[model samples]
Target chain A: MSQLKTKHLLGIKNLDREDIELIFQTAANFKEVINRPIKKVPSLRDVTVANVFFENSTRTKLSFELAEKRLSADVINFSASGSSVKKGETLLDTVNNILAMKVDMVVMRHSSPGAPHFLAKHIDANIINAGDGTHEHPTQALLDSFSIQETCGQVEGKKVVIVGDILHSRVALSNIFALQTLGAEVMVCGPATLLPKHIRELGVKVETDIKKALEWCDVANILRIQLERQQMKYFPSLREYSNYFGVNKQLLDSLKKEITIMHPGPINRGVEITSDVADSDHSIILQQVENGVAIRMAVLYLLAGVT
Target chain B: MQKRLLFDSPLLKVTISRLCQQLIEVHGDFSQSVIIGMQPRGIYLAERIKEELESLVAKDIHLGYLDTTFHRDDFRRRDEPITPSQTKIPFLIENKNVILVDDVLFTGRTVRAALDAMNTFGRPAKVELLVLIDRLYSRHIPVEANYVGRKVNTIQSQKVLVELDEKQKEDHIWLITKEE
Candidate 1:
């Protein structure tokens, strides 16, 4: 059997180019189901998936929930807010209790990084890291890869500049790894304090000016300026972050017509991205969200096959 | 559970080999001809046929499985449908002869629906239906098996079933009367 048969999807770096290619090929085979009216498969009918969400989300949770349903698997949602997890239920206790339920897979989105690794090491079922703290969100990266593949004929040799708070964005970290794997040269541009200390080692050039980053890139992925990053002493204020590193209409003008825009959702609207640029034709943020269901469907189908 | 016999016994090796030789002889040099199996038994039939053809030639043959459950008009009423098997037709089937393989030919509704579902994948040059047992009873749809293994003239009350060993315990065929 292929390594994919028993693999736990924890991050983008865990997958090689061959694995990504296999996933793309598998996703291509499933292209028909998405176009069909029924939009379901028997591949995962007998399987059960548990969506353990500890964060507030509409798009991510719904996409994952719909992905499980689309793959014909029984889906169960668990939120720490309403569940016993709110009352001092440890992560291990929660996972162990769910493990007792005999679920085949756990698609988890936790605010703490390395929690998925902890779960996969302990649980028998396969674990998929949806979004873990400000560390890595593998599925978002995959969907972004799918979206990039759709817009550009291929990701190879394309200059993709990711702009905004890099130190506190999991989507930024994941997207950088994914874009580079698909053969894109990535450039991260943001304020000095918001950027990583060792940004160059992360496989991309770092630019302080957003306009310069736009001029040197074909695709611009402007990350959300997570309001929570304000409390971390990364930057002085959101207004300063917006004024220095925000992707406004002026910087959007700096981008050539061929340059595209991408963002891993819940945009700050006027913070990291202005209202005009967020609603601009270059924005593939909504497309990324729509593709989330389809991409997650593909992941569930493949991972559930292994399960 | 109700386990009804569909066909007499597993098809003899000689019979399957002969069928393979015949397919090779009819469709000479299996390049453009593709076999699409209608699950869950047609898949095995297609595999056996492809193995025979591969022994005769040295080319990469594309094989696909199409589950006709969702295509049936009685889709919602079928309790719960399984996720259809992967259809691995990497190349578009614009001008290829799509030989659809199935195990039993009863009401012909399955083949009729299979054809309807195949159109969504791509337009094939031609479509030919193959069946292990061609039961000439309950012809609700105008589907005729072009390639038939056995044509049993049975009453509508009787039933025929086929089982393959690829993913099952035993390979056999049996016939039985309706339980009701």
Candidate 2:
């Protein structure tokens, strides 16, 4: 009967330390499951899950689908473009229609900040927020911490610096909440305009200089520049943002200690990070992607209670 | 809180030693064999048996651990979520004799899940079951252990508790009757 306290994984801020540990520990088991010769389990065979993406995604959608399929669940994929939502139907109507088909879980990514949270309140099925606007991407944070735990042995007592656009990146907020809850010291490094207001209130320090931030941390989770979310130019241009906070090999090699690098992907190469740094040994980007499936599987499996 | 002691440490130790001797007689130096303990509680018995076998035969045996939390048949139908245990199998069991160890064999559903979970690693040459206690007539599946420490018959409302030295002050077996 040991399970997560929360019914819905809306945000990392809603979870405590033990919940995060429970997730990471469960993910360790799923990681072993995926590494086996036959990488499928009949855990959710009797259950059905729907991936409802109101926002466009590449990695997140594919990762959720693969995770659900690997768990042997009946999966239904719905994209916003061709779905009833694009035909002037409300969010609730579209979701209720999906629910009427007897879906046990819904994994959603939306352009609104509290879309999943709102849907969770009105719906009976389990809700997992894949990414909710610029508010939170809980699974990315979970997988990031999971991958860091796999690399550094543990997350507690380690220094993690999230670099780049904080205001427009949901990944940064979730990572901050997750890392801080797990007892890791977190710092945000980026341009002042790109940073969120009152971010220091989150119990993390702000370092505008990327070099100093990289030098003082055990891991740097470099966020990609969310160009689609940018309405006006946050900084002067992409060139200025790259000059200020972009992580490249030369900048990484200049540091005194070697740190693990991570990025929640769909990377804008040569802008937020160079190709060499993304593909370097210091980077765990691909591992993050691989761990994404295990983490999502753990989330879905935990939510789908055991008999 | 009502409990009845079935076996104490001295008797349990003797029974485990007997099981180890039986394993050695069947598996012989255990070079072409592997021992996989069901995770959580069964690991304690598996470790104890491994230690006894090594001491009796003066040879090391390959040991592995398997967790069947995610492979259960009734996972989605349960009222509460089930937390998973770690699965660690460092060596491949392909074409090798495999011994699946557990503390008690009750419904035999766990053994069935273990069999399903083992397919991911590789096909074993053969698989045998070992348990400290066998609950008579309680098996939902037709699983019978190759080596058994003891067998007992119980009603539907009773539960068997196996306390190991790893988690308790001493090793003992208990049968508890739930109060109405």
Candidate 3:
């Protein structure tokens, strides 16, 4: 008897081709269900899923809430704006209280990377890492893989460059690992201030040179810089960052017309990338957002053991 | 784009009919046996098989309904279903050949979930599978059905649709040529 089940999806590194396929299959079913007259399943009726957003999130938190509700799971959202986390309550204390309420699962997003993992050890409820600092957004990576598989056909042998804020983007870390695992040539490029020193340990080539990275890739996944978290005196200026690393029209023209551009939004337009580049025909960023729902639906169902 | 059927000249319906004959011979022992279809298309194929088997078998066999929406691998990515349809098995599947049925074999997640779904009901003596079309594509899991209706090699992006009059009011197998 193999211990092959998805009670918790903490990271993308834990997933294999089998796990990815399971997620894709689960999303495909829900995709069909949403097209019907009635889009709901009684599979998880009365099950409570606590959404702990210790940090700010728009698309991801709603996606998880929508996913949970679709499977008939009751959802309770806890955002930092009006939560005890801002009151300096310990993360463990808050989580333990949620556990005390007997929540079935905890879909958490925190400013710290290890937040979800920390909750996983402390709570009996399933812990799904919504987004944890700059560490890794596993589900985002998984959904991006699903979108790539759905649209681009395969992940293997595709030249995929992740441009912009590599230092503060969790999606970049997770996507790079997943893409390379599926046999894609991975490249990372950004301003020296935003890009990390060494990602080569993960077998990815780091390039401060943006034009060359774009030219050598089939897909360019743009990363958004965290505006609120940008410390003073780290980088020269936002305008300076935009001129060098931001994917403006001039930079976009360097790539082949067929090449696809992606961004894990809410994009800091004119800062890390231009508005035209983010909304161009080459951009699959919107597709990624749409597929986010389907992919997350797949993730929740798989982890919940729906089938 | 010139539309053409890449499969062998033999019709899919005829292939499914022949596969039915083979299944009747192999699992002819109707005792403790059940055929649960993986909805929404597999149910139609199973219904047809049930009709065919009723005429041949001496004993009345058990026909079960399975909607795998609840048993899917990705529940977080899509809109939720309001009432996940019931999984009704009239008779016990103890020490029986539980032949799971489906339309297409793509990434093997459906089959994977089916295996997981089976355990929730009861432990079966044996689990066999009969697929209408085996679209040879990327498979993440090592899963194969006991019986196959047709084997059509296709690209990863091809849309494989198995329509039934019961649901779509259209009965045919069609592949979508993806627009790049």
**Candidate that scores best on TM-score:** 2
Interface RMSD of 1: 8.6
* Shift in Å, residue A194, candidate 3: 1.9
**Which of the numbered candidates is closest to the native, going by highest DockQ?**
2
Give one digit per residue, the lDDT tens place, for model 2 in A19-87: 888888888889889999889998999889999998999999999999999999999999999767767
lDDT of 3 at A258: 63
Error of 2 at A27 (Å): 0.5
Q: Model 3: per-residue lDDT, tens digit, A71-149?
A: 7788898987887777898999998888788887889998888888877776778789998888989878877877777
Greater-lDDT candidate between 2 and 3: 2
Candidate 2 lDDT, B40-126, residue by residue in tens: 789988998888888888888888999988788877566776667888999999999999999989999999999998988999999
lDDT of 2 at A218: 98
Ordered list by TM-score, greatest first: 2, 1, 3
By summed lDDT, the worst window of 10 consecutive residues in model 2 chain A runs over: A298-307
Model 1 chain A: ten consecutive residues of lowest lDDT:
A1-10
Regions more than 4 Å wrong, model 1 = A1-6, B1-180
**Candidate 2 segments whose C-alpha is farther than 4 A from its true place:** B166-169
What TM-score goes with each of the models?
0.68, 0.95, 0.66
Which lDDT tens digits does candidate 1 get at residues B14-35? 5566666777777778677888
- Model 2 chain B: worst 10 consecutive residues (lDDT sum): B162-171
